[model samples]
Target: MKGAERIEIDRRYCKGCMLCQYVCKYEVFEVGQERSALDYLMPRAAKLENCRVCRLCESHCPDMALVVVAKKKGKGKE
Candidate 1:
């Protein structure tokens, strides 16, 4: 949680729907100008620092295009 983790989106399955953004309370996503493999402009993760690793966006994605990675734990603190 100290650093940001990357979020992967599969454009082939994404439908350009913003439900992931709508469901994210952290405001981690934004509507992007890039077109998807589905030939539609898809939403992008514009603010990853705001993400809480809540997995809400992954669960809310209708086509399951979103994948979130949690940061790796550092040395023996856990």
Candidate 2:
């Protein structure tokens, strides 16, 4: 099954434009009260299991803070 291991958002570089949340189809991101290093409110990965690893959020991030880590597929043992 193809899935995302996790989504890493670099808070230091995040501008909290919410482009990630806006572009996400699976509703993986949500507005968070936590502030980033830049003092901007960051988007939280609320529903990680909903992520399809489509990378729309990563591509849409103007600040390039979003990174979607895909789950590695395991080889079948004979």
Candidate 3:
């Protein structure tokens, strides 16, 4: 697999559960100081390159606020 392109945490729906941090095996997420729309502290993608696109965080998120977009393969060449 090409791995992850980006990791998105929808602030509008996110409840700052930190499930993404708990589930990320690569330690991609960090404890963020920024508060969301709901006034809950959010998690930030601190080490994006370390992610393997496992989607464990996305599935574990209770609010369905996390989205991990995988990098597409074979655009033209390697």
Residue runs of model 1 more than 4 Å from their true location after superposition = 2-4, 76-78
- Clash number for model 1? 0
Please report how far candidate 2 places residue 60 from its true position, in Å.
0.7
TM accuracy, model 3 = 0.87
Query: Pick by lDDT: which candidate is best?
Result: 2
Question: After superposition on all CA atoms, what RMSD does each candidate show versus the true structure?
Answer: 1.8, 2.3, 1.8
C-alpha RMSD of candidate 3? 1.8
Whole-model lDDT for model 1 versus the true structure?
Answer: 0.86
What TM-score would every model get versus the actual structure? 0.87, 0.89, 0.87
Q: Sorted by TM-score, highest first, which candidate order results?
A: 2, 1, 3
Model 1 alpha-carbon miss at residue 78, Å: 7.0
- 1-78, model 3: which lDDT tens digit per residue? 447889888889889989889988889999898888999999999998898887899999999998999888877845
- What overall lDDT goes with each candidate model? 0.86, 0.90, 0.89
The number of the candidate with the highest TM-score is: 2
In angstroms, the error of model 2 at 73 is: 0.8
Off by over 4 Å in 3: 75-78
Query: Residue by residue across 1-78, what tens digits does model 1's lDDT show?
Result: 543488888988989889999999889889999888979888888999888888988998889998998777789744
